[model samples]
Each structure stands twice: as C-alpha cells, then as structure tokens.
Target: MTSAPLRWPDAADPVIRGDLTVAVAYVTPAGGAVVTSVSPLGLGERENGLVGFTTSLGFPKKLERILRNPDVALAYHTREHGFAASDSYVLAQGAASVDLRPSPERLAELMRASGPFLGEVKRGPLWDWLLREYHQERVFVDVELKRVAVWENLAARGAKAVTGAAWPHHPAEQEAPRNGTGPRVELAAVARQIHRLPHRLLAYRGADGLPVIVPVKVTSHDEAGLHLDLPAGLLPPGGRRAGFLAHGFQPQCVGLGMRTLTGWLTVTEKDAIYAPHTSKGLAAPPYRTLLTVSNGLLAKYGVWRAQRDGTSARLQALAARRPTD
Candidate 1:
C-alpha cells in the first residue's frame, strides 16, 4: 500500500518500544528460510539507519548466516507479557548489517535501551559473571527497511496500505502439488510439541525476496503434511518453501524453548500444508541462574568458534552522540 517508513503501529507504539520478542526469518545459504523468536529489546533506529535488534554470540549459527545474506524479515505478532496491547501484525523485510563485538560503552547503551522492557539490567560481579555471555559479548543487527506490511489482525487481512513491495494476490485456486512435497515430521509428535506452546508462526519468502510470516493454527495432520488453518488468507499459493516456528518464553528472558523447521508448503483456499525437511531447536532451563550459566558456556564456545572460523563481527556500536552511563 505505502512505501518507505512504516507507521502503522506507530514508532511510539508499545509494540515497537517494549515487546518481549519478535519472530525473525533469515535466508539460509541453500535458499530455504528459518524462523526463530528473538527479543528486539529496545527496537528502534540504530547506527545502520534502520530499526534493529541486539543478539549475543551465544547464537553463532544465526549470526553467521545473517552476515552471509543480509536479507531478513522481522514479524511483530505478539501482545503477550510486554508493554504493548495492540492487535496489529507488523512485518518488515530488508538488508541486515551486523555490529559484532561492540565496545563496552555500546553494549551498555543497548542494555539500557532494553531496560524498560526487560526491567533493570542485573549487574554486580555475581550477576555479570553468570550472565556475561548474554549481557557482555553481543552484536547489533540493523535492518535497512525496504518494505513493511501491516495487517489489522493476526490473520493478516485488510492491509492498511499496499505500499512498497507488491504482495501476491490470491490466485483463482490453490496450485497443484509440486514433486518432493510431503510430511516431514510425524503428525502425532508435532501436535504433541506444538500443543505445549500455543504461539505458532509460519514464514515463507515473499515474491520480493523478503520473508513473510503469518499466524497459523493447527487444524490436523496426516501423511501429507501438518495441516494448518490460515488466519485470514494465504498470500501466495502453496507448493513453495517455508519455515515454521512454535515457541514459549517467560518475562526477564529467564527461560524459553522453541521448535523451528524448514519445509515445503502446499496451500489451498481453505487451508495450507507444511512438509518439513529440517528441524532444530533448544529448550533452556526455566531457572534464571541455570539459563545464565548454560548460555555462558554456549557463549564461550560460540566466541571460540567464531574466532576459529574468523566469523566474528568486531564492529563498534556507532552511537557516538547517544549519551550513556
């Protein structure tokens, strides 16, 4: 509908200022997409001239992929335990630049930026030593917004304006199934896992080379694929590549778990089907100290791997004039 700067939820909207997390999709080297839930803590304009998110070295695979292909998508589809209370679903896709291994001053600012949404940062030697991987070794990924789409509801119906990139108009009917399209995971097992975490999202690359994520509900499953009830309407016909993510998290970033998959999709007028190909995820202990220590170990390993492979982004956070404590 519209182009350039997105203002549907409003820059000052609580969703932008203090959402616990958003689903991000990045392209894999193989051309498939993967989705995960991450905190864009204090998401707003950054050094890269676009809204951004900070991530820790604890997740090296994710960081490396972003460095390789800057194209990424961010979807704000939650109004849970956060400062926001809106029904809008915002998806922004653009090139991403990583500021890895930021200076202490920059890291502190990023932490302070997230203070309001996550509560005061836990410091002191005891807390810092335990949570160093999370609070210390970090990077910022700023997205150069190309296109942003906002829908009135999670179902993604009734676009506010059809600005920048042209979205796929629903064709006359669902396309015929493509070869190599079938169920990846056992329906019974998938249902068991998703049932634990109610929030479900599916992401597929849009026609413009960006990822489009939408809310989905599982209707049933069989040998073909995991059947999903589309929220509003399926933008593109099925028989395409997609990613699925189901997750659950608590406030303060204490504990979390998620299931992610890369799959083939088949869409019809009433529903869509996902045939997963690859799957990977993590489940952190719910306790703060435990989670912190676990991340500490992973970060230690990640930093080493990043160093060994020479994939670290040791860029300084260029918030030169942003005064910080």
Candidate 2:
C-alpha cells in the first residue's frame, strides 16, 4: 500500500529549510528509546511520503537497530528562550532503512553543514583527524512515514482544533487536513508545561535486551541528572545505558504537541551530580524553568510525607537552596 503524506504549513517549510537541528529516535536492540541530533539538511521529504536523512556508517548502534527493527520516530521543534514548547514540536512516526552508499562528498557536506550547530568546536589536530575519519565513513538513512502528529494552539485563537491520530497509526491512516497556522511555543513555555506535569514515560533497555517504558515521577532536578522516585519494579535488570526517553503530554491541549527529552538517564541513590561525560555541559543547573525542581513531581511521589499532607514546601525549599554544578 502507498504511504501517507506528511503535511505541514507551507510557510513553516522555510523554518526547516533554514539551518536547524533535528532529533531522531530509534529503538535499541534491548528496546530502549534513544534520541540524538542531526543536521536539518540531511532530512528531505520525498514525493512518495518518505523522509530521508544521512548518517555515519560509523554510527553503528543506530544503524544496527534500524536494520533489526524498522519502527522509528523523528521530531523537530523551535527553541524560543532556550526551551522547547509542546505546541512548537512536530513528531513523525515511521519505518526506516539504509539507502545509498557512503560517499566522501556527502561526508564533507555533512561535516561542513554540522559545524555551526556544534558547541565549542576546537580546530585542533584532533578535530581535523576526526573529520578525516568521518569522510571515510558515512551513509544514508531513509524514513517512510505512516503518520505525523503536530501541536498548534487553535482554540486559544477562537478556532476549532482537530484531534491528532493515535501514534503508530494503522496502514489505512486517516488524519485531519493540515492548516499550518499555529502560534509557535518557545522552549521555555514547554519547559514550564513539563515542570507542571511531571508524569513522564521513561524508556530504557531491559536485562533481556528488550526496550522497557515505565511511568516515573521526577523527584528533584540537579545538574547531575533527574532524581526519580520510581517503583523498584521498574528498574531494568541490566546496568544503565547512555540513552533514555522522557516524554509527557498535556490533555488540555489536545491538538498541541507532546514534549520529549532524549539523553543519558542516570539513576542515583542520593541526589548527586550529573555524570561528567554525559550532557557535554550544555546548560548548568539552577535553571529557572527547565532546570528548576518540580514541586508537582514531589507531590506526586509523596516526597517527605507530601502525598499524605499535599504539601511539598520542605522539598521545594531544599531544592531551591541546593547548589548546582
């Protein structure tokens, strides 16, 4: 059967054409959801409703997983005030496969186009050596979409909104026509929504090498990592992996998008510092919205007797006073 076409605002196409970074998520052999960034130029929409992108053959982890299981998701969003908004995000659920052989010219193009988005790039001998290696190894990944979900706040403007189709849609997918006229939500606004709604799905790999998604509550936020108070039953039998998926959605904004964070998830017995190698020092803690600890999370987990009393002042005060690295 033919695939469904991905629809977006024609005007918004320029935003994607402009220099922007996109996030791609794939399942690990063990079943955990891993998310990482790629250059927007690599993503192209085909006439047959397929979205294609290029990656490094050297990046074997993602490639092997895609070969084994074709299910995947691609996401893009605009950052306003350094936070991602629920309404500003777009998610594509599709199947993926490798296409085209690795070529030096394509590798060079990727290296050149990606340099601007990278943080603190060093032009030293090591950097040049890595570039040489990358040119030797790169390949293309093609994703064919079955469904697309987006968030735009139309009700806020006194218009009726369309409900998005359920994810992993059936082959005979049916969805609302694209209007493409939604206000952009900044990253800060999305961060606020996530903070207010701390109930998130945490994805990880299990001991059997299958993926596992569990419901977790945010305990505290620190530079170290997210402190989660989860049911002991949810811990994976295998040791931790470098990738995790944290996702949440707002019921009030049905047509608006969902929020997802893909990064290394580390669990700690006591609230501790985020691992040194992880995160690569993007933003430090003591964050106002994104980095700030969520009292709602504390209340949900009943931290310090909060569940019984419905008050988290003690934990809230402690989180506010704690020093961040």
Candidate 3:
C-alpha cells in the first residue's frame, strides 16, 4: 500500500470558480479511507456544474460483509485550473474499511467542529441555525488509513507522486451498545393540549377583516391521546380581540414552550416542537402540527356574504378573495 499527503486550501481558489468539494470514501475487506478534492463548482445555479466527476466505487454491502471480507481501497483525483499542465493534477488513494453504526453523539460533536469546512457548502450557511432550532441531526462514520498515495502536478502527462502505509485497525475497535434509555415525551398529546387551550384562536378571514375564532372539536383524543380538530367559524367582525384570542396565538400546554406562540402561527403550513435538550436530542418528542386552511371555503363564505348583502364591501372583498390574500 502507498501513502500520500492531503492538501486543503485555506480559501477557495479564485480561478477555480465554484464551491463544490468532492468527498469519496472506500471500504474493502481489509479497511477503509476517505479522499476529498476541493474545486470551485461555480456560484448559485451553476454550483452543480462540472469541476470533476466523483463516484463511490468500493462500498461494502453490509456490516457483516465488511467484517467478513475487510479489504478496501479508494482514491480521488483533480486537475489544475485552466487545464494548466497535466502535471498540475493531484491524486490520493488508500486502503479503507466501512464503519457501521457510528456514534450519534460523537457525530454531532464532529459536525460542530467541521462547521467551518461545511459552511463553505450550500447547506453550510443554514446548518448551524437549523441545528440550534432542533432541526438537524448528525450521524458519524470512522475510517482509519492503511496506506496513502499522492500524485501532484499530474497535470498534462508528467506528475510527482508520494506514498506511505500505516496499520489499519487497533484494539479500540470494540462496538458500543446503542444508547436507548432516555426521557420520552408524547408529542401528539402536547399538540392536542395546545389545541384545547380555551383562549387559543385560529385565524381566518371574516366579514369585517381577519377574524380569530375558537376551534371546534372534531374528534376526542384518540388512544394515542391526540385531539385532532379544525377551527370553527370565524368570529363576528369588528373590535380588537384580547388575551390569547388574538390571531396566531400559540398556547403553552406543556412546560417545554419556547417561542411557542410566534413559531406556531407563522408555521402556516407545518410546525413541529420537541422537548429541549432531551437525551435523544431532536428525534424524541417530535411534535408536528400541519395547518390546512381552505381558501376555497373562505372564498365561499365571502360569496355567501355577498349574496346575503352582509355589511361593508371591504368585508365582502376579503371573504371573496383567496385565503392566501
């Protein structure tokens, strides 16, 4: 086996023109290694454009297969900017193995550390924010190098090469049991409890303007204790509503409320809530609520009001318009 040095640029090369960085890992019967090549794939819509082709060639079918077989190898190659000299190209290859069932907690830590490298990618900008909002999860895979080979300035035809070999595995290869014991909170119950709050109101268009009305119980709590229902008729037009009766009100039925009201209302489509800092992290208590408003129904209500000559043209206009309006 051969060894090679991995070079990572501090900043994206201007001549390269894109932000894509290719990562390729190979797992074989003996071990596994990862090779990454960075080049500018371009900006915005052109990001996915060509820099170099990437493919995963030697992935093991399963953990059992990897353990039984164990031999693997992987390599990555890239050319210099402007097609300069063929010697300007680079290649790195090594023996590799597949690590199955990586630690979730450790993976999260690694992601936090790699924030800088990841931030350069498209999803990098939103990664931290999403993670903070309990929107992202992490999983980890570990690899040890058995050998490394590098070819630099392989640009046109001439290239320089370097190689090295190392041990693949160590005594630390013991598998740990999956983390299971943790506090589990019921999400549907929480949503139902939120829905049942007496002061909470659902927002909809009415005869006067935006009206906040209480929801009618469509069905009682099911075996899972979820009180699923829809909002009732709009409130009578006129006068500012008080208390939690305001449009877009989020009720705190559970102790784990964080930005409850504001987040829930704006969540006009789908919204979810999870227990803060649980052992299972974002996966547990995955409370989700999908708001389905009927623009057609609201329009029909306006049509009925117009046909009945209900007060004010503004009210009629609002009712007749689409729900999105």
CA RMSD of each candidate after superposition: 5.7, 19.4, 28.8
**1-325: candidate 1 lDDT, tens digit per residue:** 9344543335325556657788999987655678999888757763233767887765777876776677898888877777777777777778787876478998878777777666666668877776676677787888887766777675666654443456655433223335466765666777787778768899876655677788888887778778887765644664777789999888766668788988788786776788877677778888876776787778777777767765553322222212241
Global lDDT scores for all candidate models: 0.72, 0.43, 0.26
Error (Å) of candidate 3 at residue 90 is 5.0
Question: Which candidate number maximizes lDDT?
Answer: 1
For all candidates, what are the clash counts? Answer: 5, 11, 35
Error of 2 at 91 (Å): 0.8
TM agreement with the true structure for every prediction: 0.84, 0.44, 0.26
What is the C-alpha local distance difference test score of candidate 2?
0.43
- Higher-TM-score candidate among 1 and 3? 1
lDDT of 2 at 17: 43
Q: Rank the candidates by lDDT, best first.
A: 1, 2, 3
Model 3 lowest lDDT segment of ten:
276-285
Model 3 lDDT tens row, 1-325? 8334333221222222222232232232222111122222221111221122211111113322323333222222222122222222222222223322236664455445333322321245544433331212211122233333333322112333333342222112212213321113454444544543332222222221111122222244332222223321122222211111111112111111211111111111222111211111101121212111121233334344534653234332433442343
- Total clashes in model 3, counting residue pairs 3 or more apart in sequence or in different chains: 35
